[model samples]
Target: MTPTDTRALVAIDLGAESCRVSLLRWLPTGPQCTLVHRFLNNAVETENGLRWKIDAIEAGLMEGLHRCAAIATEGVRSIAVDGWAVDYARLDDDGKAMEDPYCYRDVRNITSEESVHAIIPAAQMRVLTAIGIMRINTLYQLYADKLAGRPQAPWLNLPEYILERLGGRRVSEYTNATHTQLIDMHTGTWATGIFERLELDPEMAAPLVLPGSIVGKVTGELATLPAFADTQLVAPCCHDTASAIAGIPDAADDWAYISSGTWSLVGTLLQEAINTQPAREENLTNFGGAGGRILFHKNVNGMWLLRGCLDVWRAAGKDWSFDELLPLAEAQHTPHHLLDVDDPDLLLPGDMPNRINRQLLERGFGEISTKPEDAPAMTALILHSLAARYAQVLGAIADITGKKLKKLYIVGGGSRNALLNRLTAQATGLEVVVGASESSTLGNFAVQMAAVESSADAETIAEWAGVLRTAF
Candidate 1:
């Protein structure tokens, strides 16, 4: 692809199982981003909690930046990092990371959510902040830490912390801030009221900045590097879901989006946050989106169930690639059993096979397959269950928001699942559009381009994104 006319900007998207770093070369006609590097990301079960291998991710990020520095024709202009939310890195008095951030699936929230909900009823909590109730949310994680007798560390959320570590200022992007449940959706500030009820200090939460704001520039040891001199840091809907939504090329308001990935986030963008009781009852979250929009969606257990089940089978010596199993699983005619994928029991850790089997039995789906060959059917059943659940969430979103959904754009790693995508289309009965495998990074670049452009608007960003897509 011919490179674009404008200067290059890099975006780093940190994910649960992987980290991606890309460079967007903006042209007068449009833009194009080349992924310079990608690396495996893993969370370790630490003595304190389930935490990210933060240093490794940093090393990987730097290596990617170094690659960007190497290939840049004209000097690169800026860099930014965005990742999944709720996980944060504790910092010392001098701002060094005291410890790695905890993974959202760390299972530490065994008892903390109830405690927070006791004082703030689920419905009131929604009215207070317009945050949908969910078990793995940041509020629950924070309460879990306190209940475990751990003191609050002078911590920074991942997005702010990454920029700070790169010698940028400290501030959480508004989109990511909304996930913490510590931010009041109404005031666009930290929810001191919620923190007080939980008896936790609220000052440690990061400040908010709009998407596309220049956070700072690369400094520290890497500052001397050739590529670091002109590198600017920008926050673009740093939350994975928010960035994914921003990357949608279509501008039609009637279209919904399913950020199909480890978590299936299904929703439509709204200018106003829907804090009504029905929205709360449906557990529909209204997170901050790019261009000051709200992402009205629900988090469905996405590819994680499949990934976890495969992990268990792989441990038993049945090496299976997703591609290898897709056809076999797809051929499994009628589902022998289906799961209520949203069941809280499915969210925890254990022998996922046993757990799924137990669930099937509990639901009166009868006995499950015991042989290794039975896995394809079981996996298909899981996917079918997911599609069924997606239908429920899609309808729920429309019902709560009163918005007519024209289409659903699926993005991210799991968006590549053709089998599941087709099923999702059939279930929702809405036109399905498969979008960027690197949507979050694209959104990051789109926001940066918008920030740098003279007249930035959501429509403008989406238009630029359509042009930038030639890189794919």
Candidate 2:
């Protein structure tokens, strides 16, 4: 423990498919992190659409925090949270959430998105915000809400929504806010003009805060947790991708960040948005980032293809594990065909392999196999295709931004896949550093440390980040 006894922070990270709560503590043994709890998270589809079950997730985190409180002799100094971007909740005037927010994978926005393109034109939005042309963006999601008739819900982005209900403050973090596509590229604030265009109530949107800001503290029954009542709640690059990028140890100019998870977020950090014509054509995004940087990245269809294939295979009784599939595919040699992971059809959930096969057939690749042996080969091909796509997208990001990124850092769950990693290194032709798979947790702790110190600036945060490079 530290000389004063309080030697750590808590960071809670939520994802589309899972959630984790960990305690980062320092001791004579040096720094260590204990994962107090983790749970699977899947959007529960409702009459409205696919949405997160926040109550269940919060319950899991509470149980985890309680466990951490039991283990630590002294209370942690602070806590922070980060989660998947683009999904959020509506709050009532009293600050209670109206309902669980829609999942980014929901389909209703498909219709409204075309209208979004018509308003600003997809090309124009790309030039203005450097965001990709996706129907599931916050802009399209909010537009879908206005069409549904319930207009004036309280403004709370996902992490803020959860933190607020736990007695923490209600506000949006800029890194996550940029994912909303409603934030101005240059000003780094909500684009009032875009909201006006969508007829969205500006009041319903929360104010944008930055990473390392202390919003509030957990309250209500949660406040009763031993050693946690006095802990401050910090906003730490609240978007999982943003946090993952922040976790990268290097501060050099020519580095790229590949926050590999369910999705492969391949991009680099920039001082400002790359809102250029070529960037627009490439559908490259300039999302708000940690340390006041921009995350210029693209979402590549990632391990989802393989996972989805396994899911279907398991239902059919094959029950193959990823470990098993890796070797099987590695040994087999088969002629390959590829499908664009970003195809609109693949965006919505269902039989992913079937969708992939169907798309391949439409593109004249012919039908694929249902045999177990084929799963591995197909999965490898999928990974290779993803690597190729990453290279393609990064090339454009480099062209549009005029930045020469020579190194790539891969983090999150998918980074554990060595096969994909080697292929990515080969495809990008850059020196690759395998980062701690739990980058969000590191980033969460980083921001908490910075928030506790009022004088901490971007440079200071970057310096302290060396602590993370060692923690792993």
Angstrom error of the Cα, residue 392, model 1: value is: 0.9
In candidate 2, stretches whose alpha carbon ends up further than 4 angstroms from where it belongs are: 1-5, 454-456
lDDT agreement of model 2 with the native: 0.78
Cα lDDT, all candidates? 0.81, 0.78
Q: Candidate 1, residues 17-136: lDDT per residue as tens digits?
A: 889989876555556578889999978877877788888988998899888888876767777778898888778888877767778877767567778878888778888888877777
Highest-scoring model, lDDT: 1
Candidate 2 residues 416-446, lDDT tens each? 8887788888888988888888988877776
Model 1 TM: 0.95
The alpha-carbon RMSD values of the candidates against the true structure, listed in the order shown, are 2.2, 1.9
